[model samples]
Target chain A: MLSGEGPIFLQLAQRVAEDIINGTYAEDAGIPSTHDFAIFYRMSPITSAKGITMLVDQGVLYKKRGIGMFVAPGAREHLLAERRAAFRQQHVAPLLHEAELLGIDRDELADMIKEKDPS
Target chain B: MTTAIDIRGVSRRFGRVTALDDVSIAMPEHSLVGLLGRNGAGKTTLMSIIAGQDRASEGRIAVLGHTPFEHGPTLRQIIYVRDNQRYPDDYRLHHVLRIAPAFAPNWDADVADELVDGLRIPAKTPLKKLSRGQLSSVAIVLGLASRAPVTLLDEPYLGLDVTARSLFHTILLREIAAQPRTIVLSTHLIEESASLLDRVVILDHGKVVVDDETEAARDSVVLLSGNTDAVDRVLSGRPVLESHTMGAMTSVTAAGAADDSLRALADELGVQVARATLQDLVSAHGAETPEPLELKKAIRV
Candidate 1:
């Protein structure tokens, strides 16, 4: 999916992150090379490489000397932490604000969560 | 924090044809600047001269306060990534990764290794065996990991897909934010990369046509749509880059901000005013100059 209107490199970085989450690139598996990505996407190689490098910086992926890159060990945990932080910032706080407006308390929210998931 | 590139009265010519004409520009440090124009607008030639790959027929160029030609220290601080890069036939992706650290003082092996995994590049695959996209990936990795103070990417996104291109934009911004440097990106995808640019330098027929902050350049061109007569009256003696007509309606893109009086007059005439986009500005200027590709073809014939 197209990211928000911004630099092309950022959009590419998001796509790679999404791909990791979606399992298009499995943990510990090598992703497509920059040249391959460029040819597949008809983009410049440098552009494709930018996306890969961003993932590396985020610790979602790690490199192997003389070998191709692999999904870093504990990458899923790292991603989960990041996603949880984002969820709280992007969704939970706003949700809490609306709950306050509706006069819902901690017990009511707990009850709703319990009803949604018994286990 | 000084200017990354400084050019004064720079000119280049190929026989009777002028590739760059008395051009002068100072690239600000730690900013992403877009070098834009139609094909053969001297974008490549100017970049080449600045990178020290080619010499300017006249004038002077200094990168990092040193003349770039054969200047080892200065050259190392600049990375020029282009589509036409050549590699030895026997060389493989591994070779590039291996030697990158030696040349790039700030090279991050971990970043390179992570890229290799994410990109799935074959370590043993020869350069000739790799696909076009694979070759481009090599260039991308080198450019980013090099961490040069002055990084010039010439159409670096040519062979990438939408997803890959988006990733590139993200990484470039994050990296630059973490480690600020001067970056000059040349591309035809104006609208896509417009926001990333701090400033834009547009060339027309080897001459600098538009050089301004990206926002200011966008602000200088105003688009107005209204009655043809009223539009014509306001546009008279003003610099109008382009105009379109449909029956009694006319849309004129005039250079400079619309004054209060002109805005009021336009409103009285039922004219709609809007900001002109960078693409619109470039298209309007490009139309005024001879197409660079056409000129090259003519010279060839």
Candidate 2:
């Protein structure tokens, strides 16, 4: 599932971040070790470590000297806030561009988004 | 990290054929390096030289700072199993299992047993009678179970089934975590094994075409596709690896990073752009070149 266009390490970091945002890992909950990540992802240990390190650098994950890595306190809120800031450019803009190409007006797009059940 | 294996201007010749030509690569210790190339691209020749099984015609190789050829101490710390490994005429799986430990000082018998069972190798069958996939399984058993500090695997996935391949990967990663060691694996299954590599060294026509960290290599090229004229304009002044022209559309693998200006031009010209994958890079380097693996500036990654 991690196989994407960009570097494997970045993809891995994004996946973990998505999981945190979804509550798969709660605050102070320990994530899998680097070795476990490598085996599960079929990636090298070094790559797995790099991905984990990136999260640590971003303040999303924190390391315990002898134990393992755990989700940083307030990491989910931090990631949600960050993603919300970029949601316009990453999701809404291209979406708007496509809607424009399809001749869907702004009002019609708003209506389309408001409709919950499209039977 | 200190260098585990170092090759300096290593060249190998067989009669009139030049198998390796002044190749040099310094592999960092405890890293998993993917040795990739097309068939007969001198990958095997280079592996053999590093294993001390074959000597270079010109240049030298140092493993752990000691010349490997005919050096018993150094050889003991390294394990190299060829793709087409051969056993005695009457040898069987048990025979190999019993004798391998004598050579590999750091061998782990439990790892061997786990692999043999995981791969479902026939223990009673004669060595010569095993099928290609079975032979590959046996080679993997030796390669990983040996636990050598410097392990060289030449085409370990030659004939492995999907299940067996998955098992091999799991076992390899587990072993590396338990015992950090330098491993250089050569294989043609680029995408399947790309993630398992920390670094990648691509060879074509006996020369180092692309050598860089796997993450860096993946970001070193960009793919552009659109109308022929538009793509041609954006691709101008770029070293193209592979290009396809179908009717009015053209798709190309352009070497080097795609700068903002280039991306802007491509966006304006309706040319879609994406980062090149590892498979794309290897195939691009393998593609016929004007000067046989040219694009020297593109190798920095």
Index of the highest-DockQ prediction: 2
Cα lDDT tens digits for candidate 2, B32-124: 999998898999999999999999999989999999999999999999989987688899999999999999999999999999999999999
Output the lDDT of residue A93, model 2.
98
Docking level for model 1: incorrect
User: For model 2, what share of native contacts is present?
Assistant: 1.00
* Model 2 chain B: ten consecutive residues of lowest lDDT: B292-301
Q: TM-scores across all candidates?
A: 0.67, 0.95
lDDT of 1 at B289: 34
Name the TM-score of candidate 2: 0.95
DockQ values per model: 0.03, 0.90
Q: For model 1, how does the per-residue alpha-carbon lDDT over B1-301 read when each residue is reduced to its tens digit?
A: 4788999899999999999999999987877788999999999998898889989899999998998999999999988866788886699887888887888898977766766666666788888877766676777788788888998888877876676677677667656755678888898888778766778999999999888877678777788888766776665556777776666677777878767877887777777887777788788778763223223335545
User: Which sections of candidate 1 miss by over 4 Å?
Assistant: A1-119, B119-125, B129-132, B289-301
Best-performing candidate as measured by lDDT: 2
Which 10 successive residues of model 1 chain B have the least lDDT summed?
Answer: B289-298
Model 1 chain A: which ten-residue window has the lowest total lDDT? A1-10
How close to the true structure is residue B23 of candidate 2, measured as C-alpha lDDT?
97
